[model samples]
Target: MDNLVIAATERSPAVDFDFAAGVLSLKGESYPEDASTVFGPIFAALEGFLGVAECRALRFDFELIYFNSSSAKALMNMFQLMDKAAARGVTIEVNWFFAREDETMKEFGEDFSEDLEHVTFNLATTQN
Candidate 1:
């Protein structure tokens, strides 16, 4: 599957979805005017990648500096999809990175990590 690589902008984050390398990364701030429009293609690409992939290990990295409530909902959906994929026997690892001073982002990661059973959630604090 072709990878999805979108440069970060003021209203959106950078998305680097690599199927061959088994690494998916979403980084930067996200507060788009239309959350569904911004995330629809991303979720579509992720679903397509998972459908044809035989890779046993999937690694996802999320490094969001800021996001609105709508984007948060979209992120939850993304995690849910990954959780389902993991439950289907795919080995998944999710690394959630937040700024050292961002307690809200850390809490968000913790909340998402709760329902995940088959995936390993790693919370990391970064300077940037």
Candidate 2:
């Protein structure tokens, strides 16, 4: 499958989804003008990829400097899907990278990690 790559904008993050390798990464800030529009295709592609994935190990890395509530909601939705895939026998790992100085981001990562039952979520600190 073709990889999905989206360049980051002033108000959005860069998305790199490699379907063949089962690796997906999102980096930079996200406060898009319209959060749903920005994340809609990403979710669609992820759903399509996961639908056909068979016991494959998937890794998702999220390195966000900041994001609004809307983006957070979209992220939660993505996490839910990932957990579902994991529950269905896919090996899933989520790495959430946050700046050392950003307590809010760290807390958000922790909160998000708590909701996953099957996916392995890790909170890693990045240098400032």
Candidate 3:
């Protein structure tokens, strides 16, 4: 599958999902006016990547300065999809990055970890 790489903007985060390397990364703020428009293609690409290979290891790194409720919902959906992939015996690892003082993001990571059985979720704090 082709890599999904999108530059970051003021209202949207950067998306660097490499299907070949099995590494997915999202960074920056995500409060776009149309959350669906920003995330729909990403979800589609992820589904396509996972559909082809069932045993590949997937590593996801998410670092968001700010995200609206709609974007949060989209992220939850992505986590669910990853969880399903993990259930199929795909090794998955999710690294959630947040500012050192941002407790909300840490809690958000914890909440998403509930649905994942084989996926290893790590909450990391950055100095930014």
Candidate 4:
């Protein structure tokens, strides 16, 4: 299947989901007025991909400088989807990248990974 890519806008992030490569990434800021509008397609595509990806290493990178509460919710949903896939025997690795100076985002990444037991999760700070 073809990959999913969305350019970054003032209010949203850039999404790069390469299903064939098993590497997916989200970058930039996300505070879209309607979070669902931005994540709905992502959720669908990921769900479809997860259904067929078996025993494969899938790395998901989150490199967001900032995001709103709604975006946070969307992020959590993405994590849940990943966790489910991991539980189903998929090798899912998640790397959360936040600005070095942003303590809040760093903490958010930690808090978000607390519930994911089946996936390998890492948090790293990116130099601004």
The CA lDDT of each predicted structure is 0.91, 0.94, 0.89, 0.92
Q: Write the per-residue lDDT of candidate 3 for residues 1-128, one digit (tens) a residue.
A: 78999999999999999888899999999999999999999889988887776888989999988898999999988988888888898888999999998988888888888877877999899888
Model 4: residues >4 Å from true position, as ranges? none
Q: Listing every candidate in turn, what is its Cα RMSD in Å to the true structure after a full C-alpha superposition?
A: 1.0, 0.7, 0.9, 0.8
lDDT of 4 by residue, 11-38 (tens): 8999999999999999999999999999
User: If both were scored by TM-score, which would come out higher, candidate 1 or candidate 2?
Assistant: 2
lDDT of 1 by residue, 55-113 (tens): 47899999999999999999888888888888887889999999898899999999999
Write one digit per residue (lDDT tens) for candidate 2, span 33-91.
Answer: 89999999999999999898878999999999999999999999999998999999999
TM-score of 2: 0.98
* TM-score for each candidate, following the candidate numbering: 0.95, 0.98, 0.95, 0.97
**lDDT-better candidate, 1 vs 4:** 4
Poorly placed runs, candidate 3 (over 4 Å):
none
For candidate 2, the per-residue lDDT at 78 reads 96
lDDT top scorer: 2
Better of 2 and 3 by TM-score: 2
Model 2 collision count: 0
Worst 10 residues of 4 by lDDT: 42-51
* Error at 121, model 4, angstroms: 0.5
